[model samples]
Target: MKYEISGKKRFSAFSLYTLSFLSGVVMGLTVAPVGAWFLAWIALAPLWILIIKNEKLKIKNSGEKSSFLIALAWGIGYHGVALSWITGIHPMNWLGVPWWPSLAITLFCWAFVSLWGGIFVAVWATVMARVAQQQPWLRVLIGTAVWCGLESLWSAGPLWWSSLAYTQSPHNLVILHLGQISGPNTVTAAIAAINGLIAEAWINRQYRNKYLAIASGIFITCHLIGLLLYSRPIAQPPAAALKVGIIQGNIPNKIKLLPEGLRRALTGYTNGYLTLVDQGVNAVLTPEGALPFFQRDLMRTSLASAVQQKGVVVWIGAFGERGRSYTNSLFNVTGNGEITSRYDKAKLVPLGEYIPFENILGGIVQRLSPLDEHQVPGLPNQIFDTPFGRAIVGICYESAFPDVFRRQAANGGQFILSSSNDAHYSAAMPLQHHAQDIMRAIETDRWTARATNTGYSAFVNPHGKTLWISGYNTYETHAEIIYRRQTQTLYVRWGDWLTPILLGLSALGWGVNIFWQNDGNTELRS
Candidate 1:
């Protein structure tokens, strides 16, 4: 005969918290760059279980630090494990830095990035304990809303940068389709909703009963909506055939800064353009920072002359330095070798492009990539007039943000030109990178021609289908992208309206729960 312990122990609380965080990590690891997104549902089950157990034990009501500590510990564990892939770059001898130092830095970076999601979870757990009390549905709804609100408010949060939702990527076909309406924020909110549902089920101890039934209904509703949206086929614009060639000059990020390697890098790009010209391509697009050095009048050079002689337009990506500030710029070269139009990259990478607090982190910037004191942010949503058609240019991380592309489309951008270099970051980033391009395509209802330095070059149609894509393991030699244009999508017109409304509804729901004690008591049993 075994003696049974009647009370909830501190160890059990720790175990539950640990399990919640671990589930998040496992869920994150399953999505993108590695497309095992089916785990999103699986990961939420444990969190739901814990929430139910916590309510039954009245741990949320207990005047104890156990719950808080458990949540924090779980957050740390989840972020630490999920973002481990970022640390992969640390071991490599980048810029002659030693492995240990790189590893330490990488780990710290991952830790910082993971903290956003952890903080959201911790706060949600606390809020549900206080406001929702023992009401599971209200608890889940509040938790999801608060998390999504924070994600929107703090765009710089870990949830924004290195997010679990981003990992779901192109494989999360349903969410990717939803991205057309609300962008990635919708997918993120959906993940939070799923997690909250799981937590509520566990708290109520009705995990297999009403919980499954409700979750199935919600899932089916979302899936049906996504299917209907995708089923509405978009019509392509009937424009004259314009042959375009996208050059993916796989320039090594390390040697790009060296003075000696400048010639080689420039030659590589020139040769790629020449090949495209030889193939009788009407337009050629190059990857971002294809030119190591920048000249004020790049189009007047010999490189432009050869392309002009070929009677084709060439779009060159380079770092344009003006007075101490540098801008990621795209130059449009005419057949007569003239700089017809230029569009500077608007959305700059936080740390990679420009550090927020340069006064304090200027030294750190110098140590990392070869960026100067500051890389100036460009004007929001500038469209370049290409020879073949009107094109919106998304440079590097600029593609990830919907506003950038939305504004361009509104300004008469018929197609998209995305130039990125993922070599400086880990190779694994391209999977999500690819997904982002597709989402942008669906949002704008325009075809996208993405040319990356390392890999992930592709042509994505308005239907969120990849007409062309390259492998990620190694550098693709070159890509000559050609695609038809599509009309503007509804999502491009209304950028992220659903997410804000959901956030407002969530707040209202919680307000009702908190202010009206009578309703709260009635729902406590439900």
Candidate 2:
């Protein structure tokens, strides 16, 4: 039966818009720095309630649908405030960008992305509301499947930054364990289900108690699953544990271009790596492009000396040249005095490392960027041969892409190393970036080491626990033990099959239901 409230109460257009926008604001607070993960479970309840109660079309757009405008208001509140960190980059003084122009570019980029994403969110809400008009009980399932599938679809959202699962990151590892069972989308689905239940309880007085019970059950089941994952031992008996060291020169991005700055960086890293070796560490990791020069120049410098010394392996980040094209890559060198293996970052940061759709939007991007971003992206699923065993390396921006690590782990990488230069942005980025890397560790069940310039460098276990970490904006170095694993989790072996399948079925079910509704209407008239 269709779910309807006791009364057909009409909410004002202003009230509905307020409800959606306010809910979105709550949703935005669930991520890092403001890690109030609890809000994620019910953040969308108000918006969902608004959709269920209001059938009248109020908001209008001449060139667009009503749903787009409705979602845009919500998205402006959510993504606008959530992405405000980008506006804090201070590119005016650093990149020679004019003050007002920098603010304008940042605002436009934020608005465009937010509004673009709002279109999809609006569509999802509209469909869910339609489903509720028929089988109200199915709305929760539909919401779960749609949202989970949406998050798994890498191309669905702009910049691949709209992961619903990433919102509960770093703090909500309990709920986060669902990612291991069925990718991050499962976590997203579970959160959506909670909001759906909340909306159900609010609108349908007859089913209020039933809705509340179902919501509690779902919450308990998710957390219990999380408990089971967390309670389990992360590591089995390892064949061997490799002692790895990380060195952060803590060189600020602005000064790295100067010759004197490069000299200081070279001296600092050289001292740090050699010092780690002296401290009996077998391997030392450096930050992304830590040396700030070409491979030939690095080979001719003090860095090569550490590589020449027997039994010590230096996994350093640098630029790889292939006939004028350069790549942000991790180069593996050992006491053998030559490069053994290298992994170029396959997933480059959009605009930061390489411009997206450059052939089409080249001139527009040029005006925004400070550096010559002519970098070529590397091939996917690369695993490097290290002294310990196979290893996966993510250079800088690739930490955001979990598939990079998962594929390598499946290919028998014992551990993951993600080297980044978070110095380009403010202090907040490092923390958020570190949280993203933690998800990769949990996803792959590999001991992960992240070395970064201007900090949040951490040693993460298979369970995504931060075993050891360093402060931001400081020159720091430390060594830790990393384990070698031999088993594959279901997610690593099969990828995100469940999410896509669920979403596809939901869309099919909705289409079929709509066909029946129209057919019945004609039959009744006849």
Candidate 3:
């Protein structure tokens, strides 16, 4: 087990960790809307290589403490940078809180979430090292297993989230179809195996190790198989056509709150709807909170001429309240000056949307809004009816969770819609956020329309392809964006089953290895 790194270590552990973390942050920008995940992949490989070499050296010197410290430090550094977008929350002018506390809360959440990635790396390093020392190929199996196992527990939906591997999907078009069969967990497993196999090669030049070759072959083969499988398009729905108009008014919060902001917001959507009406779209949609205030009665009556002229269905986002609780809501307004129905957003953002433990965090949440609990989490799942189709709506940021869209399709949503306000994060954030919709479309095999206040408003078909998108940093409108019904994917049908199987198989393999080793020793002694 000759394990020392070959060259003089250019940097101390802290410096290496910092470099790795910075790499992760910069690399993560490639995922999703950014579409630069391949760079992250290339950047991340060197970090693992460094870790493997350093750990091997420590093992040779019998430096047990350095091994864990090196591993943990790398884990912290990598995750801290990879998830830095989480800190965007700090600068928001919610309820009017000072920027510092807002940013502090967001940073704390990112720091908390970073622990999961850290734990995965910490345990994987220790286990991979022990196994690679003996059967070098086992590192590939164990690494993939551990990564998939952790991802399975998180699931890919609303309440729980998984993000690391998601960055890669947007960067490489190869995995566009990967989500159909095993979902992102498959990609995560493959990525881990690739990282592990490469690190194993760095540790030892055991060129003849059949197990390593076999493991690497199997890993690549599975991904290739996934690529082939994903080539087929989801079967289109046998349903009637629905006309829809999406308005990207690109409203700014600062301007939106001014004396004329509400009128501007209302006018933009009304004009967009009129354009759609002339274009013969059956339904018109607007981004989340296109209207600053909730005006159930006003929308029902005051806009009668426009509604009458369009003479169709309109779905829009606004503030809705019941008693003291207010909601960021979607409303179905009909042509005859009638309020058809309303669905409130569930799964509110932790600090930005609503405070979880109001008694403890109420003071903080209230500082940003007059109401402590601004929006209520609609009961588990709800779908709204529109002339265009049955739409499962998750307000902005809700699309990040896979399950929110999955269950909607399971329960009969023909298409998924996210009415979002990304104006807060600037144009770059929306472009990045659109990538999540691609995964959701794959997971559910449903078309998704993301209408944003600032930018990245786009349409994703069932196959995870973008049909149309708004220009960055601009107020815009997209019309006649056709929606489709897609055949269900394995992921949609079975939910998170693929991830659990990977975890279970790993446990079984590890247990069998232990038993087999014990038996072999006993036989030799006898």
| Leading candidate by lDDT | 2
Answer with 2 or 3, whichever has the higher TM-score: 2
Off by over 4 Å in 1: 1-14, 48-56, 60-82, 91-100, 156-159, 162-164, 206-208, 237-242, 300-302, 363-373, 473-486, 514-526
Q: lDDT per residue, candidate 2, 43-62, as tens digits?
A: 88876765655442222321
lDDT of each: 0.67, 0.76, 0.66
TM-score of 3: 0.85
Q: Give a tens-digit lDDT track for model 1, residues 431-457.
A: 667777777787777778888887788
Per-candidate TM-scores read: 0.86, 0.91, 0.85
lDDT of 1 at 59: 45
Segments in model 2 whose C-alpha atoms lie over 4 Å from true places? 1-12, 56-64, 129-132, 155-158, 236-238, 367-373, 504-526
| Model 3 Cα lDDT, one tens digit per residue, 1-526 | 3333566445655665565566555555555434666554344455556555665555444343444455555556555654556665556564366778777766777777677566655665666556544454555566677667656555432333435556755445456566667667766766666666655666566563653675468556865875676676555443645556688887777677766776777677777777778887777778888876665444653344588665787777888887777788888878775666777887677656766788998875577674544567776777777655567788887876677777777777788778888776534456557777777777777777778887788887766678888886676777655555745777778876767776676667777888889999999999
**List of clashing residue pairs for candidate 2:** none
Candidate ranking (TM-score, best to worst): 2, 1, 3
Cα RMSD (Å) per model? 4.2, 3.6, 3.9
Native-structure RMSD, model 3: 3.9
Query: Can you list the residue pairs that collide in candidate 1?
Result: 32-167, 48-198, 48-199, 48-202, 51-203, 52-202, 52-203
